[model samples]
Target: MSVRLGRIGYLNVLPIYHPLETGILPMDCEVTSGPPAELNKLMDADKLDVSSCSSVEYARHADKYYLIPDIAIGSRGPVQSVLLLSRRPVEELDGRTILVSAQTHTSAALLRVLQAKLWNIKTVFTTGSATDVLGTGERPQAILCIGDEALNLRYHPDYPHRIDLGEAWRELTGLPFIFGVWIASRESWRQNREKVEEAARLLLAGKNWGTDNIGDVCVMASEESCLNYDEMCSYFDGLVYDLGPEEQEGMRAFYKSLVETGIIDEAPELVFLP
Candidate 1:
């Protein structure tokens, strides 16, 4: 049986998916593209055999999936994209309303964790279109935007206070923050182990190719997004794709914080396919 792979349609993930899109990896499979939340829903419905989904998804449903080792979308420092845009200072927005982008899950959870553990602020969160919130002239005191949208609005002077969630996580925990991970359903892996293995190999190969050709990837991504060439290059430069020992430790730390914040029931063990 052929595998169905879910790819995140975000500029931040371009490095990993560019090779696959350009036929550099040469794999036989059906590919679906969507945001993190949409991919999470597809995986939950078993519509995707393998997908790069929000890291929080695995922690929430560890029994149903096995993480594909050695591949992820993360950062050690400021990820130029994921930002919390605030009209007022972050500390000053304690009792105010915050608008959240519906495109992400991990970032949302990270924001909650930051509020509870670091900021110690109680604020109300409401979900809506990031574009509408930013452009409608009716902006909330704080707004959470991720991916390309966040990258575009981060430098705007209207929102004076911009908080990078990745940077905040690094400062709070001193570890690289993992936003997304490639995962395969446990049932899919058990039934078509060879196919899943082959897909995983193609993904890793694609990521490696993209990393070596960063300049080309940045040029292509810049053409597609509003970010200029230099900004795109700088953005991709800050992103980390390796799921090394340190990233795993950071993932666990994030899961622990999520549990402590009551965002998730428990921090699941990291299980990988052989």
Candidate 2:
């Protein structure tokens, strides 16, 4: 049987999956793209055998999944696509309303963690368009935007407090934040482990090639994200594209915090691929 792979169609992620898109992988896998959180829901419902999932989803379903390595959408600092645009500095947001995009739970929760843990900010989220946060006489003090929305909004010159939340996470933890990871369902791993591993190898090689030829990758990403060449390059370079010890630490910390705050149902154990 062919595998169904759910991929993220974001600019920061596009380069990493170019090879797969070009049909380089050996396995007979179909790639369907969507928001990370949405993909997680599909994976849970068994609509996908493997997906590039929000790392938080892996934590939420730790008992039944394992992370495949070599390719990931991670950032060492300042992922321009995941941002918190505010009128005031992060440390000063208290009792303020923050606009949140309805799409991504991980990005929203990242902002919350920064507010509650690092900035000591007391904030509430109002679900709405990111543009609405630009203060039409009365706007939220800050706005949380992720994925394509964040990429689109970053071009505006008006956001005086445009802060990269991924950069902030690095400052707070000295580690790379793994925004997403590739996961294989337990049953699929047991059934088609060799093909899955081969596909992973191709995915990694493709990303490595993309990185080496960053100029082409940048152009492609720019077109994909509707960003100018410079903006696309900046955001693309911010991502780390691999699973390292530091990124794992950041993922674990985020999971632990979510569990402690009762956001996650339970603290699920980590499972690594062989």
Candidate 3:
């Protein structure tokens, strides 16, 4: 059987799928690159067998998705790529307007969790990229920017106020934030468990190589992101490439928040391999 493994085309995600670059996926399986949001839809539509998807996507389609453990895009603290940039102080954010990135469900859900549990106030939540959103409002109170945009926003001198959502989640939950996970459609996996396991094993091997050569990964990432090597490495440091106990807790907590807010009807538990 043929498998189309969809993935993100970003430096941070490169290491996890480095095996693809090195031709490590089984010959019958093909790897393609796209944002997590797109991959999630593809998986839901049953157009792909396995893909790295946003945890929120799994929650959205609980019946079809199953998590692939020991591999993920997660963060312990201060993940530079997922941030909430505020025009004002975070504590004074009540009844203020905020723009959220339309590309990521995970980032959008995190904003709801923060508003519900910490801020104790909710206002208008709109959708757009950081630039488009910032341009739309007279002055947006805050804007949620994820991926490379968040990293770029950190360097801007004017937007001095910002909060790293990953760090904030850790502070709130004492657990690492799971940003992304590999998931397979249940129907696809039921027919091809052995192939899926083989692909996962290759991914594990690639992750090991990435951890061992972080310096080179950082260098390559710098070029792709246009950040200095050191800046890129610092962003990379906060990254936890595997899903462990802490990340699972964080992921579950996030899903619980969605359930509480009525964003999703129920929490999706992680589906693991024996």
Candidate 4:
């Protein structure tokens, strides 16, 4: 059987996936697309062999997967997609309730760490569909949004104050925030080593190709997103596709913070697929 791969159905990953989909980078695999949270669940349920999943997923289940080397969906600054839209300045939000999107794990944990360590504020976080709050006429002081929804809702009329989580992490620790990483199920890998390696190679090569031909990618992504071509280009510029030394250090820092804030029991060692 071919490797079962999951793709994040978000524009932020367009630069990594566009090449493979268009046959610019040949790949032999079965692919499924969905939100980060959904993909994370599939990975946990052993329904996917490989996926670009929430970094938090691997951290929470470190023993279950192996990280694909030199690739991630992360940013050094201003990740337009994981955002906290607020009715007031973030600093003034102590004790205020923040509605968190059900479609996130990494971003949610990042927000909690920031609230505890950097913002030094005590806020209540409620998890639910953002639509639920809107439907109930409950005006949460802020709401967290991730992926395409966050990008599109960054300019919500009711929430004028925006805090980009990636930028916030940079300010707090001077490091890039890794939202997601390419991971392979260990059980699948132990049985289909060659297939897993091939999948990783295609992803890495596809990432390179996509970034190099970003203009074409932007055009394609624009059709499926609320943003224009120029906006798409600007968004891609802020994203990081490589998990280099600094990014690794940043990821470690994030994990450490998560541990400190009790979001994680301990820092999970990053087990890269060799």
Model 3: lDDT equals 0.78
lDDT by residue (tens digit), candidate 1, 91-189? 898889889989899999999999988899988989988887667787678889998788778877778999999999999999999999999998899
Runs of candidate 2 exceeding 4 Å displacement: 24-27, 131-139, 155-158, 223-226
On lDDT, who's better, 1 or 3? Answer: 1
Collision pairs in model 4 = none
Residues 1-274 of candidate 4 have per-residue lDDT tens digits of 9999999998888888878887878878899999899999999999999999998998999999999999999999998998999999999999888999988989999998999888889888889877667678777899998888787778878888999999999999999989999999999999999999999999999899888888998888888788998999899999999999999999999999888888889999999997
lDDT measured at residue 108 in model 4 versus the true structure, 0 to 100:
90
Candidates 2 and 3, the one with greater lDDT:
3
Q: lDDT of model 2 at residue 245?
A: 75
**Tens digits of per-residue lDDT for model 2 on 106-197?**
88777777776778777888887676646465556777888888877775665679889898888878878888888888877788887666
Model 4 misplacement above 4 A: 135-138
Q: Among these predicted structures, which one has the highest TM-score?
A: 1
When superposed on Cα atoms, how far off is each prediction in RMSD?
A: 1.0, 2.6, 2.2, 1.4
Quantify all predictions' global Cα lDDT against the true fold: 0.90, 0.77, 0.78, 0.91
- Cα error, residue 237 of model 2, in Å, equals 1.6
Which prediction has more favorable TM-score, 1 or 3? 1
Ranking by TM-score: 1, 4, 3, 2
**Candidate 3, 1-274: lDDT as tens digits:** 6677787766678776665576654345687777677777788888888788888998888778777778889799888888887767887778877777777888788878877887676867888777665465455667788887777776555567888888888888888888888877777778888887776676777788788888888887787676899988887888998888878888888888888888899997788753
